[model samples]
Target: MKLLHTADWHIGRRLHGFDLTDEQGNAFEQIEAIAKKEQVDGIIIAGDLYDRRLPAESSVAMVNQMLQRLNLTDHFPVYAISGNHDSATRLATGTPWFKQTDLFLHTALSQAFKPVELADTQIFLCPYFEPFDAQQYFDDDSLQHLDQAFARVVDEMKKAFDPSKKHLLAAHFFAAGSSTTDSETNLTVGGLAAVPTDLLADFDYVALGHLHGKNALHMRQARYSGSPVKFSLSEAAQEKGVWIVDTDQTPVKLTFKTLTPIHDVKLLTDSFDHLIHSTDDPAIDHDDYFGITLTDTQPIPNVMARLREVFPKIVTLSRQDGFSTQVRYQGESGQQIRQKAPMTLLKDFYEQVAKEPLTPQQEKWAKTTLKQASEGGQPS
Candidate 1:
């Protein structure tokens, strides 16, 4: 059976407060086109279908529309699972009737045991689950970490494997030795969640998610399809795409098809004057998301405001010199610091201390707490 593998859609995700609705919609269009061109038997979305557990109403509507186009309108079976960012209860709401139209949405641990049988293949959809979820499912109190939970989970999946058909595992988790980018949330606590790659040796093919770069994991039988759109500055240079897996072959023939982003993420480094002047160049796409690093040793007055006038999509700004540190430590003025949004200040501090951006859950919690603090009330 041939299948188009993709993951980390992160619908409704924004790049530094810039809405990515158009970019995400464009990605779905490309994916649909690719699926049609390839004429695959089915499509596998490994995980992270949405950016947050509590997505906006518009995000929900958009996803519903996109899924309808893929599964109902175009008539392709879709096999998907919930990622860490997803709310399992919300995803499971309409799942009882989803398979009637060839839509298989797996969000719970119990759903993983029963493989979705297709032509010559049995696909085990393993959604992201906490150690406690696995512990409760198995009645094993010792399953305290992700590695331990996955060990038992895989063993049970193997028990239900059909010897006559190819076994494929569609899962969402961080694999041992896999690389990560700024866009991906760390699923580990001092390496507790990293599942050993060797544990997944039994599957004919392992389709993974959570990591945004397709090259994050390098294994003969496993691959990460990655996010179709860039979510962070660190992923500006990463090629975004999907994988076409031909499972009929002895060794699955995997082919990557690139998806064009509506507005590509770009990193521009030059002196402040040069960057401002380059905005007038017709060759430069001022609409594309940009992360700028100024080479000027001295700070420019109203630099961000000036850049915003020329490049309307500048997502991040810093300096190659120590200007960024100067702004953080010895701010231009206390008023300047006070003028920054609470969330922005929190994000800067979190990134500086943790060496990574806050996860969606963390950001949401921070926002809630900040709101409560501003209102002089405690969270209920």
Candidate 2:
């Protein structure tokens, strides 16, 4: 059967603190259009259906609308699961009703190792499971790693797994060969939980998720479709898309279909004043969202206002050195700050700013300047 494989929609997710509801809405429309145009038999979302455990009202509405449209034709089925970032109970609340309409959602650990059979194919559903959650499933306490837990889970799945039919698995976790963005939150700590692609040899194909980047584990049988929308600055350069796989015919064909979001987000480097003043540039005039960096030593007051005046959708700005935390004040209050500082507070502030105490010579100069200020003399 032809199946559209996708994951990590992260619907209702905010990028750079800018709400991406409009962008994500457009993405959902595009996904529906692609599904219809391709005439796929089913769509499989590996995991991470919603961006949060408690989704906003608009997010819930958007999900409902998208799912309804996807199943409107009633000819194609949509299979979904929950990831580490998702709340299983919330996502699985209406699964019983969705199943009546050919939309299968398995978001509960209680339903682990269940196989949904469709047209002679057994599609195994295994959502992401933490060590503590999967503890009871393991025979020994030493089965602490994800590899060990999944190994045991797969064995259980195999018991119910129909080996005679073409087997396909859906899961969301960090695979050994996959890479993650710095912004991606870790599901588990240490190295106790990495599910290798080798764990899926028994299944004909494995659809994976969690890593935002696309492509298989450097091989073909297993693949991750990545997020359909960019979710972070690290993902600023990625091309969001979905994967389509069909095995009904001979030798399955896998296709990656690109889904472009309405609002394009880019990390743009511009001269401070140029960014502040350049309103005529095409990139600055459009509805695109931009995270700008002012490559200057000092930023003027009302910097955000000036930027937004030129680029209406400019959401974030930072001086390249802004990430640098050293603050050297030279105003009239600088001397008072130097003289009236409590050592504890001073040390805490310095630690927060990633700095050490001033050198002996510098400290002497500061004290002298403070003493002069105390005597009604200007600080040197």
Candidate 3:
């Protein structure tokens, strides 16, 4: 049996406030093309269909269109699950009749016990769950941590595992030994979300989500397909794609298929002079999202405004020369620095960071904000 594994669509996701709707749509189209070219029996979306639990109306429409094309139109069976970012209740609304169309979306933890049996494999769809949910479901108060709850869940899944057929597990969790980037939200407090890989070793293959990079984990049986597009500047260098699993062999053969983003995430490091001058150069694709590191020793006035003129999609900016305003106040004692008026401090900090003094309007607004803060009132 051939299956394409992908996850973390984050359909409504944005790159530093710039909308990624077009980019995500492009990725879905590529995924459809790859599914057709590979002729896979099914497609597995591990988790995180949307970037937020309460997605916008437009996001819902986009996801609906994509799913309709992939499952209803293309005739490929889709096995999906909800992740930490999804509202399980909302996703579970029409799930009762979803399987009729070969769309299996598992939202609750209880839904995982029943495997979706296919030609040669039984896929257990395990959605993202908290320890409390598992504890209540199993009536075991001892299930205090995610790993503990996951152990019981895996044990329960093993009881129904048919030895005659290959078993596969599709889950959304931060598995142990997986590295994380800035884009992924922490699933639990105090690192309680990490599930041990040993518990997952029983399955023939484990398809995971939550981490945005496919290389986040190095286990032989488990893999993260990663996000379809770059969601954060930290993921600037990641090669986005989907994984293909062929279970016809003794051990499943895994192959990666690349999906090109509409606008790639990139990092450009150079002085302000070079970047501003390079705007006229044809070699640069200024449409791509960029993170810039300025090499100039001195702070430049209206730096972001100037850079945005050329790199309209600049997501982040930093100075590599370590320019600081602290040198001016090095001789002042901590008590002396603290004695300065709030407005004076604000003006100094703004001037140092922005490389320009505040305008009359900005100063007025800052004074009003300071007064409101001092009075324990919210700023208007």
The prediction achieving the highest TM-score against the true structure is 3
Better of 1 and 2 by lDDT: 1
lDDT of 2 at 284: 52
lDDT of 3 by residue, 218-331 (tens): 888899999999999889899999999998876789999999987889998898999999977887789999999998866678989999999999999998866655556677
Q: What local lDDT score does residue 180 receive in model 2, on the 0 to 100 scale?
A: 68
Candidate 3 clashing pairs, residues 3+ apart or interchain: none
- Per-residue lDDT over 1-380 for candidate 2, one digit per residue giving the tens place of the 0 to 100 score: 87888888888798767888888888877877788888888889888878888988888888877777887654569888898778888887778988888888887654667788876688877777776667765546866778887788788788886756788888888877666675467663345567877887787778888888785365566888888888877777878888888876444578889997777778888787777666677645346778788776543657787677667777677887653334444333656766756544455455545445766685677668767876899875
List residue ranges in candidate 2 displaced over 4 A.
Answer: 72-75, 138-140, 161-164, 188-190, 249-251, 283-286, 321-380
Report residue 264 deviation for candidate 3 (angstroms): 0.9
Clashing pairs in 2: 1-248
Global lDDT of each candidate? 0.90, 0.76, 0.91
Backbone Cα, N, C clashes tallied per candidate = 0, 1, 0
Q: Which 10 successive residues of model 1 have the least lDDT summed?
A: 323-332
